[model samples]
Target chain A: MSIEHRDDTGDRFGMWLFLYTEVILFSGLFILYAMALAKFPQQYAEASHKLNIYFGSINTIVLLTSSLTIALAVSAIQMGRVKHCLNLCWVTVALAILFLVNKYFEWSAEISHGIYPGSEQLAEMGEGVTSFFNLYYFTAGLHGLHVLIGASLIGVVAVLTAKGKVTSDRYTLLENSALYWHLVDLVWIFLFPLYYLIL
Target chain B: MTEHKHEPVPYRTFIQIWLALLVLTGVTIAVSRVNLGALNVWVALAVASVKSSLVIFYFMHLRQESRLFKICLLVMLVILAIFIGMTFIDVLYR
Candidate 1:
């Protein structure tokens, strides 16, 4: 074996670097949102009122719980509790599915009301509300994609753990997946307040 | 250089953080209902900052990361904040 070696800390550092990029990527969209809201504050608040806060709040809880489960899964693996780790990961995955299912219903309800980007019904609502819903769909859609990817990453990590590829002593994959999961939660933490809690 | 192992975070700590997050969520909801007018948005964002901090420091284990990691995170956040802050400044001034 070569004397040079890789360590988890370095791997985690790289992961954080990548996450910083993701943060910048989303910040670009948020800047757009801030400007749009600034230009049409009243219309933005009116548009925000249309969003179902109950749905948003429930989804928030679901995501927060998933974050906990995944964090626990990482802890379980660190303690060498493979089976427990597996179970927690699956639970996290299930919570992700629950969040998506809840989101689907939420989206369907809004869509049935003729609320989507570029829909004829949306265009009739005037420009500001249209922009609001359009941004809503875009941000929420991008975030949903992240949720899907994070769940799949965790799922793959769980399988690797089961096969002995990842272990108590070597679990960079698990830790990184947990970090990604938490990032998803991080984004939603902002989204819930900005979109759903309009005063 | 010698390698070091990470200490596994306890299950109870995770649970505690989870509870704290839920409570913060509830607090934001209650604050929003109080009709703080123009201040509502800032207040909402401030609470969100707190909530995200909890996730980063605890859930993502940034609290235990090396100083370099923390510095990098602060740098990234500061850069983003500058971008966001400048935009708000232009909006307010124009």
Candidate 2:
């Protein structure tokens, strides 16, 4: 019986294809956002003013740095620097957690002010404000979920890397996970301006 | 199967890219405060598109990927653009 070997290129190709589908999924929400903005430009702009750009900007830098760390981790493994790769993976996870922590505080502030999705105050503000919060919560919440998933995937890959299961020759898991992490960062790149800065 | 050689990118390049992204974030924040009227959204989106391209080309190593992968990504983006464009047509006219 002949055993088939693993194809790293094919593996990465599959990941990219899946990412394209994810892009299309998010594009649907973006279209909805654009339509809402066009319909109620003034109200959307006013609602956007309520967002704290400082927090959004900090999260952007945090995610961008994490993307670099994850990319460097992939480079480290490809060059047989397993320890370095593991350390970078840990840093990526820490940054992702920091992003979520910032998101928590930001959301807490908004919810405290009764500006969350489905809150009486937001709903009373009319359709534009209500739709703005709804899209804001949904898109950012979805991206946050991706952050948690990417961080956990990186965490598991880091353990495997430490155990030498993912070396220079067999590091597709690490590479694929890094790609996913970058996608999370990419999503946030658009989300930041769309939600926080476009007022 | 042809084995594609994996090159180890220099650590300095990653740091440089990170620094560039940070600077761009600062730029976006600073520009948002200037109140460019309706052009504000376009400027912000353009900056974001640049930032995303940097991540895609460098951090994600799309630049090093095979031509097939690049073509697939391009097609996907074109489709997304069409979707956004069609929606804008309806929204803008109505």
Candidate 3:
């Protein structure tokens, strides 16, 4: 078998294991979210409405574009275009930075406005609503942590590629890391609607 | 001709997948606007499932991958679905 086959098998197994951990990690927050939402359906709905859809939408678009960039990077590698692959990896990193910047602004604004989990704004909303806010912060905060980790993983791959550590045949790091990045993006795709667009 | 020449890479497939994702995003947003009551969760999850399948199939290259890998992934998701389903039952009932 070719190197790509072995590489693919190894990476797929590794990625699946990584994804299992991720499933467990996110399951914690999902359980809390489900319980909180069930206890305070209307309050959770109202709290979700307070979120800024414009920022959420822009972040989604950015993530989608990053996914495109990373996919193209993989394609470039398979086609034996090393430089193009590196360039696309950098583009994906840039988009991730854009996403973090947007998230920071959104979080800071929400915090300053006292929309934090147990702040007065939440207290005024009632205990059930306060619990919803609590879950929101916990879940979104956990997701943000994953985003940071994913960005760092991809950023390391980009830097390595830039330094010539990766080539067309030796790009498993990029491929696997990109798989992780896309999973992070996938989680947010569901999260955006659950947290931002619910009626 | 070589026995294993690579086909021209399907960049268009990626583009179409991206466009489909955007459409699904719109569908999710619109579906949320409708108050389906208990069914709203199913609608959202269904749209998400479609969006996820698109990414897994095209973006992640699962479609062109080995059958073993695809089967393993499906098994993983099935297990996840079972866990989520059981949790929701407890939440909804209790």
**Model 3 misplaced stretches (Cα beyond 4 Å):** A1-8, B1-9, B92-94
Candidate 3 docking classification: medium
| lDDT tens digits by residue: candidate 1, B1-94 | 5667778999999999999999999999999999888899899899899989999999998888889999999899899999899988987898
RMSD list, candidates in order: 1.3, 1.3, 3.5
Q: Can you tell me the DockQ of model 1?
A: 0.86
**TM-score of candidate 2 chain B vs. the reference:** 0.93
Clashing pairs in model 3?
Answer: none
Using all chains and alpha carbons, the TM-scores for the candidates as numbered come to 0.97, 0.97, 0.90
- Per-residue lDDT over A91-167 for candidate 2, one digit per residue giving the tens place of the 0 to 100 score: 99999999999999999999999998779999888999899999999999999999999999999999988888999
Q: What is the descending DockQ order?
A: 1, 2, 3
Candidate 2, B57: how far from true, in Å? 0.9
* Alpha-carbon runs more than 4 Å astray in model 2: A1-4
Interface RMSD of predicted model 3: 2.7
Q: Please, what are the lDDT tens digits per residue for candidate 2 over residues B33-92?
A: 888988988888898899988988888888888899899989998999888888888777
Candidate 1 is graded, for docking, as high
